[model samples]
Target: MRLIYCCGVVLLLTLFSRVSHGGNILVFPVEGSHWVNMDVLLRALHSKGHNITIVRNSKSWYVEENSTYYHSITVPVERSLGKEVITHLISTVIDFERGALPVTSFFNMAVGMMGTFTEAHRIVSEFASAMFDDQEFLRKLKDSNFDLVLTDPCWGHGIILAKYLNLPLVYNVRWLIAGEAHFSLAPSPLSYIPITGTGNTDKMTFLQRVKNVVMYLIGQTQHHVVVTQTYQKLCEKYLGPNSDFNELSLSADLWLMRVDFVFEYPRPTMPNFVYIGGFQCTPAKALPQQLEDFVQSSGEHGVILMSMGSFVSALPADMTNEIAAAFAKLPQKVIWRHKGDRPANLGNNTLLVDWMPQNDLLGHPKMKLFVAHGGTNGVQEALYHGIPVVGIPLFIDQYDNLMRLKERGGAQILQINSVDKDNFLKAVEEVLNDPLYRMNMQRLSRLHRDQPMKPLDNALFWMEFVMRHKGAAHLRTESYRMPWYSYYSVDVGLFLFGVFLLVLTTVFILMRCLYRTMCKPKVKQE
Candidate 1:
């Protein structure tokens, strides 16, 4: 017994001696669902003995003043987003559905981003200026001497902060980002990948490709005009005279994109681009007693969950009435995630609440199908649980996600405006009754789970990989350094075309001269 105890102690000592503490990592998460992204990563890093400080601009589930895992700094930011911007953006989707927004759904998103850019810029600037101007706060924040900076490029301010701290930067792309913010760190061609808001699939026709190209061109033409001015001014003010944000975005050490071929189609990615999709996910959790009772009370009929995400809480009265009517027709129990007033004449089979354990609810054996507004998180969760989806996508990437899910045969999309009881009933029936949907969902779930390492583990591996290699500059592709026209080979194509046209014109001119000389009136001249 004495010898065994000594051996155990020696083993523990050896393990402790082998553990190497990683560098300090600073995380800046955007407000809303994006905050939920860190549930796994931050805690895992903490358990591994790394210093993690989260910069909190608003209230969220992930952060507290003090925790065993991490520390959060409270920064008051007054600007409120989501409600008005999304309402307006979705109102345009009605246009696209009706063929009024033209062919380029990618360009239309740029227009929406244009309308909201000023507000986004203002909020980011205020947050940045607040951090910079506070003498004591700034001193304390800088005193930590962080080694790496991790940011969600929901806005373009993280790169600036990385510059301020003179630390290695790693950016997190929180969504598919097919069009909106992908151009800087990665390249997504139109051959396979669709635009973010456009309901296009990988198999696009020639005309669809043409529309996609036009959208890309329109996005390129207006991209710099809409976003860069504010970024440049803020860079000058906060980061010195010549510190441009554009240059910083391209030069970031790594880009962790929340995308994968399991959910998204295959696309070209650079060495610095790491796919960490579904990292925010977990293996489900135990349901609270109330939720457990609710599912149990449903008996063998099972239940369905309705969630429109955190940002979209309100539904038009007419839309609400339609969804309620559809629930009334179904035998399965209904659980809706809503905070506002409930629709009148809601069926006894239906229950409404502001919140429920969504992941747990999805993982329930009684969960036959999920009715969601098609947020990436919600859609991905439904996919993870291998539950067929009845998608009522509201705005932005939701539409694109819904389209992809439909193409994958695991979902049926119900249009918000055209969602009568019949259509909603049809979607629910199709998802629940069709065995094919379940089979497809199961396939995708397997693919998602079959990776060499867990998504969170893969994320941590790359995060530390960049830190270990001292910024991983060699992973950044030469394409980032190429000028826009040169990167697209537009200048080269145009130069070659111009030479061909010059030669053709010269030959035509000479032929005309020679023909005239041959047909000349020589006898008259003599």
Candidate 2:
């Protein structure tokens, strides 16, 4: 009887202990596909007994107002980046890509895209302003006594909010408002590490390197004038004149990067940046019976899965017809996630659904090739499942993501503008027929899986680590605090150059004097 009573007490103690250790985590997430991955992390944290509270805009496109895992705090905002805006931007970019004049197309596309980016940041800045203007909300946030702030730095709202709340900040980050998080945190040499949208691999020719440098300058200018302009004004008004949005954005205690060395080119990184690529992936669950039957029907030919990701619901009608026609030429069964008009040329073997279980389908034994738009999540998931890709990249970082896989001999990239039945068929057939593509991807999968700890677990540890230590100040570098001249040691180099010139001038003067003295006649010296 005493033994049983003691066991019961121990069980109760364990349960209480878990509840006691729960940390109050405040999250500020970005919308669309970014939120998809952020939700995965939030669920994981909730399962570990952490209490999560999310701050979202009332006009959120994806985030729900209610959830069992986390409490939602919705800020009322009049405007947001809606679906229509994104769809129109995509359509315009696609049209530019297919334009007859290449130079005009590229120039217009660059300007229009940058303008869209600037406007989006401006809208995000307004969202942050709305949050700040609410006195009751600010009081509630302060009273909550949150342990840390987890945010996606693509927008600057979270960074500014974290500063206002005086909480330790951590990032569920890939792109910053400036650009890729690595460029902001690490030593990214333009000679090697390819800038996003440049489409150059780590290995580059002379002209490519020149192009890389030009793009780097253009990107930096865009970040300053286009991206940070609105955020900077908000920072000055709320956080005081000394506050810099760019600096605060880089001041996070930890960066849980959504990529790993497996998918990224080898480059320098900092201690605080943790790679948790494919952390959202898990073993496949049982597909619905109907879907299972479809997979089984494929038999020896296997199945090909295609998805354009969360934002791109469908392609242009003509492009869709061309893709469908290409699929008709293949022996394999096809499952494409599309919400566009039904293509007239769609093959009987192809199944078009508004949505499908992308991750689960990729894990299926009969899965053969992935036709993807080169989003980070899809690409990482593909790598995780050891599936080779037939990449049809459309916009912004999609081409770059495909380029990385292509560099590794694991995928084939087709230009969206030029995609037609013949070229699309050839690309798909090459990836499907080629054994090397599968082998290389499998090798990468093994490498990704062989890690000492799971990426998700590592991310959790770092998040909790920040909570325990109050912040990871020791792990974070002070480089962000330094000016550009100080960061690159340009001041030091200039000082050294000045000192060198001074010494050289002194030596020259002394040599002239000494020669004059030595060569002078004895009578003159006397």
The model with the greatest lDDT is: 2
lDDT of 1 by residue, 1-526 (tens): 9999999999988667545455688887665667667546778877666778988765333456677778877776665344565456555565564443343444556565565556656667677777777777678768988879888876666767888888888877753112444654567787766766557788999877876676666555554653565566778888888776667767778888776778887776678878877777777788888878888999988999998886767576667887899899888999998766788758999989888889888888889899888887888888888888988876667878877778988888876656888888887987888799989988888888888888778888888887787688888877766777998899999999999999999999999999888878875687
Error of 2 at 272 (Å): 0.6
lDDT assessment of candidate 1: 0.75
C-alpha displacement of 103 in model 2, angstroms?
Answer: 4.5
Lowest lDDT 10-mer window, candidate 1? Answer: 175-184
For candidate 1, the TM-score is 0.85
The candidate maximizing TM-score is 2
Q: Which stretches of candidate 2 lie over 4 Å from their true place?
A: 1-8, 100-110, 520-526
RMSD of each: 4.4, 1.8
Q: Can you give the TM-score per candidate against the true fold?
A: 0.85, 0.97
Candidate 1: give the clashing pairs.
Answer: none
Query: After aligning candidate 1 to the native by TM-score, how far in Å is the CA of 170 from where it should be?
Result: 1.3
Model 2 vs. true fold: TM? 0.97
Please list the C-alpha lDDT of all candidates, in the order they appear: 0.75, 0.91
